[model samples]
Target: MENKGNSESTTTTTTTTSTAPSTESIGVAKDGCNSSRILNINVGIMGHVDSGKTSLAKVLSTSLSTAALDKSPASQERGITLDLGFSSFNVDVASHPLLSQRSEIANHYDRVQFTLVDCPGHASLIRTIIGGSQIIDMMFLVIDINKGIQTQTAEIDQIPQESRQSKIDTMSTKLRKVLEKTCFSQSPMVSVSANPGVVSEEANVNNNQQQQQQQPLQPSQPIGLNQMIDELCKFIEIPKRDDQGTFLFEFDHCFQIKGQGSVLTGTVLKGSIEINQTVQIPQLNLEKKIKSMQMFHKPVKKVVQGDRAGICVTQLDSKLLERGLLCTPKTVPLLNGAIISIEKVRFYKNLVKTNSHFHVTIGHTTTTAIVTFFGNKILDQSTPTTKEETGSIHQFNEKIEYSFMEYLEPTSLEYPVGSQFALIKFDHPVLCPLESVIIGSKLDVALDTSGCRIAFHGSLLQGIDASNRQILHDTLRIFKTKVKEGAVERVHSEDTLIGKNLFSKQTDLSSFIGNYLFGILLVSLSPLDYYLNLLLKRVDKKTFL
Candidate 1:
């Protein structure tokens, strides 16, 4: 009886141990390797079409996501990136000279994961590039050494071996000139050949047997890759992260597994998310709890701001969500219109006028919006300052009064002369949060033109939801001045004068009382008598007649 009891106890103990979750299952081992914290930095790879952006991403990345390297059939067939591609590589924090110098960073982080965002370079796909640019911490403006600057170099070094150095220098100088007036003026430039001198398999097979035997084939290797990585490490700065704020994830891709559920792959724009937490898809008005989460294929219990992650949620239809926001319940508002603080892009030379339509891109969504320009009356009346003397405009202040502008005049390229605001009415409702970045562009322009299509960029100062749009227009203090001219036809009395063509019969003349016309104060106005009978405050009959 004692031997049987001992055997049962042993079996029960083994069963309990087997069922217990391991450290890796709970994500204690960071990145499934060690307990070191992994810091993620997003690097955007941007350039003109056929500029080797994808090749660079492929050579630098150690781990590829499901959507990386132009996996789409359309992309492979067309031989151009149709959408954004994502891939990543791990860098040793201790080994990096610049990162290791920072004691706090080196002590806290064991590895730095660089998530490369490969954006489409086609002119028609500029909208996608604009969306991808918003999420990047740093940018790589690749250039094809053979072809100097092109339309989309916003911001490659695949060149001949003999003249590679000279070509790189020339391209770098030209790039500096192009970026001199832009935000990326001081960004470093690196030259590299992602794929160097490799014959296709068909070409190798077609070679004669004697020639092949004389010259053995060798595998092609990337040139100057280490130098590019070094430049990136030195130029990248740790951006400020807000993990305590409300969780907001902007997903660019969505798909479903057989039984696991739907997976949302995107960068965490702000705050943090964890497994089993309930999240809301505000666009669809659907809520689902997170079943699991992964960062670069390694399971993690939590992901914070700036971290690229894949979140799995059950019972959610992947078809319903292509690219949109997922956040804490009731966090994002559905907006029909917005008031934004706008500044003209220096490269755009076209006039920005009121009532004009622009392609307004907010987050990953691009839609048409009609713009109405407004500025402070005092500032508009003041003497215009030179571009060099101007300063940045402050954000929209509700306490100050503003006057309607017919159009926006050219201002300093470096800074705005005064505070400017635009009332943007969207053609359709957009799901976005307040204070989101807004970019307005004229997308209908000819793509072949050698000019910038981006007109202006700013941040949302106020969001007008569908239900409160009318209330906002009535409450906001944006005014317009009007002038009415007329000649007196006759005089009825010393205090009254009859004028023609001043006010129509349908016009409400009650609001015109106490207004001045021809240096005479109007006490009252009656529009029902086929003309305006303006009752003067104090005037003689002879003065009017």
Candidate 2:
């Protein structure tokens, strides 16, 4: 009788436990784990122009009507990526070693979507490259192993072979170190033929069959598309997402959708946006509510960090929106007049001057800013607690770790310092981890390196907000009030900050000297005033008498 009772009790307990909900179902839905998390990464393919940028991106096109190069009719004839191209493909997680041991899809085979950014390698389109870099996680520096180095701006044959080769080697070393310091320990470098001919999947299969019939192939031979894909996955690291933070989405493409108003798509760099939620375009100062949202071209309830999503917004026209803008949550405010620090790559030729002007590219938004001499400290130096407590302030070209402050209004305060490197493209800043530079310019000419059409990359140190206390408070003061349509349209223009002394390319020393000399001339000529001289003479005669 005792054994029977024990068995019956145990069976009942087991049944109750099996019926209980699993902890894994916390954020998941009845359908599946799609809503729990997204597996997507943004990758940038960078190199000199004509280094097979668009061709490489096309190699990874997701579909037939892909977002590849030659979007412009002119570029089609030229065979170069004129502006910028974006394409994505699904990569099986089974191909790369999974870094996370506790991934939800460990047991099941999962696919990770990679969004490829194809930047124009031409110097003329460096601005576009800078904008694209702001939203990518990693980069593939493509170089032609057969050709020395070629870009539209560079004439490699004109320069001495040995000298050019040595300089290229030096610049490359510096870029690789910067990439390792900023992006990850490994910077993926791929060497290809001068002109890599494209082969279709069908062709590849037939070639494989023929090869098998002909002879046995060596395992180490690197003569296929699989080898290229493997190199990309070899050292790629997944960046952590901030789902709990305020929602921020960088919009690179916007188009009109039939029956759905305007549809905007880009990578979600932070937080989450759901249908019916209100979002703000901080740059445009436009407030909008999310009418509908789609992920992977299907309607989804929400779009989380790292997922490439398209949002259909109501009460707004498609004509008003463009690239280099963002959708942020209405609850959290965007950055205004923040003082960020920067660390340039080791071989970055142009040294920054105080109040020196730079074109900053932060997450696709480009703006002009001036550099200030904050103090001499390494990496990100902390501000002093009190007036007497003098802490270190870093400047440009200082210590391997130096602290310099950059005062730019309307900057994104999402990323942590040293986490993303900033790329300067013809006075534009792009987001980063450090990497190499390959230039075909002459080494002897101490050319004003600033104007050179080359991608200059550096680490962005954590910035201290030097916003006008009164202005910041005033901004919040207005936010506390009820917001209506077109309420906060002038935030950026209101506090736009070019420092007081930023007359660039050359100093205002001549002007200052001229002004001083004019003052002296006025003082000397004032004593010669006829009436004033007579009065002074009379006073002097009276004193002498």
* Candidate 1 wrong stretches, greater than 4 Å: 1-33, 152-159, 198-219, 377-395, 409-418, 483-545
TM-score of 2: 0.54
Per-residue alpha-carbon lDDT of candidate 2 for residues 226-281, written as tens digits (9 for 90 to 100): 43455544445567767776777777677787777787877687788788888887
* Candidate 1 lDDT over residue span 88-168, tens digit each: 877777666667887767878887788999999899999899999999887776655555566654212222345656656
Score residue 455 of candidate 1 by CA lDDT: 94
Each candidate's number of clashing pairs is: 1, 20
Q: Please list the residue runs of candidate 2 whose C-alpha ends up more than 4 Å from where it truly belongs after superposition.
A: 1-38, 64-66, 94-109, 149-223, 329-336, 377-545
Give per-model CA RMSD: 14.4, 20.5
Model 2 score (lDDT)? 0.45
**TM-score of every model versus the real structure:** 0.77, 0.54
Best by lDDT: 1
